[model samples]
Target: MNDLLQTYTFLNQAMQSDSLLCLAQAVCWLDPLWRGYDEDFYHDPDGILSAALVVTRQLFPDLYVDAIDKLRQGATYATVDQLICEGISNTGIPLDNLEYLPYGIPLPAYGVELNDADFYTTHPEVIPILACFGISPEANPYHMTIPDCVYTAAEIIATDLAKRPEEQYQQVAWGLLWLTSATNNSICDWDAELMMEVEPLAWETNDLAFARVMIEEADEIMGDVLTGLYWLTSEPAVMQAMQDNIHRIYKAIQKKGKNNDAPNIRLKWVDLAICPE
Candidate 1:
């Protein structure tokens, strides 16, 4: 981090709070907020910082703004007291230096790709996390390799979907699968099993009222996701097949129910449905 900031020149200066320090303090804030939002923390510097800026600005605008000004002017203190001092007492982050590493989220251990103009145009949400981590992306594989970053990206999908009104369920579910072409493996990757709920097949037909048939059939359409044939996030045929199958299933469920609103019945929870390990 010191090496990276040294390269930035301005960011490295001693405002003792805003630029480097403020970002450091942001880790303390951001580390928990993601979980509160959806319990998924991606740990990408760009996303985390972006979120931190939103949160800190709202919570402590005066102190945060002051820190930014100081960092801009390269302000410094003579005493160099512990972080528990008045500079950032409200956050209750314990330390003298920004060397703490146990937040589970990390500074970019690998090198960062500086100043990606495309990042804003392509993934503006990421600009903030990278800035907080004191870096940016546009390199290969990218922050997706980082476990926390991976988790964050996946969670942002369902991301507190449960918090939303049940009305948007059908549309969000269909649109997401249409764009993403997720399979059982993808669900495991995203733990989207949590997001998913299979309506009990209305008992009108000879089939079990379980979603096992629908998921299995849809997964078959996805064609061997386990062997990596269609393993990536988005496959055109794969996603479309899933979307089509979902429509079929919903129609079937509605027909069985003999009503427009199929009950949101889940025969078995995902963990229970999984074969005993």
Candidate 2:
């Protein structure tokens, strides 16, 4: 169990570096048993490393696929590590000098306490850091009060939106929409009713409408990859209302800029919205 936890810690740091070489190293570490492991291992009940890997793959599909191919060809972890080091050296990101921070460094920034064992259990990828902080596995973040962390995160984002620059509003809006949709996806199994509670908070500002229009315009400019924000919601009424508002606002913006090109927000934000924690 300790070995697995250590590997999870290493992979988590590697992915956060946003380095293709580091990501490839992490993928190689998992290649030995990922496909043959039991369902529970894949689900990663102790941490969210599996989900993080999925997000890493989505972000660097080509690089990840190449790493998978090498794994299939029976590449050892040492070999893969060496290859990653070589790649990092070529890119001037000094592999030898890279110091891995204690996993606890960013926890405070997220306003999360390491003692929240229940939260760590649900979000296993956080376990290593919490362990580093000497937080017991039995401790609870909210003293077992069962606080609504997701809703709280959304509220925080909404509160801060007005303080940001105009150029960042779209990104903030995208983050809000993603938070709502991803939270819904996570709860759709048992607590599906929670989404109804989240709807009003999501639409509190013009963000939902902005996200819808951005997605619609993205589909027109890029492709269908960004067209499914409406479907992310399980409630039909909520989905329809959001879609209607999106169309209304989108049309108004188009008419108001009849001779001008539509504003182009990056399509990558849609991909970011669905990224795993």
TM-scores for candidates 1 onward, in order = 0.18, 0.18
| Model 2 ranges with Cα > 4 A deviation | 1-58, 88-92, 96-277
Please give the lDDT score at residue 149 for candidate 2.
36
> For each candidate, what is the lDDT?
0.34, 0.37
Cα distance off (Å), candidate 1, residue 129: 27
- What is the Cα-based TM-score of model 1? 0.18
Name model 1 segments beyond 4 Å from true. Answer: 1-233, 257-277
Q: Model 1 residue 127 lDDT?
A: 43
lDDT (10s digit) by residue, model 1, range 193-258: 323332222212223223334444444433332222222222334334333433444445545664
TM-score: model 2 vs. ground truth? 0.18
Root-mean-square deviation per candidate: 23.5, 23.4
Worst 10 residues of 1 by lDDT: 104-113
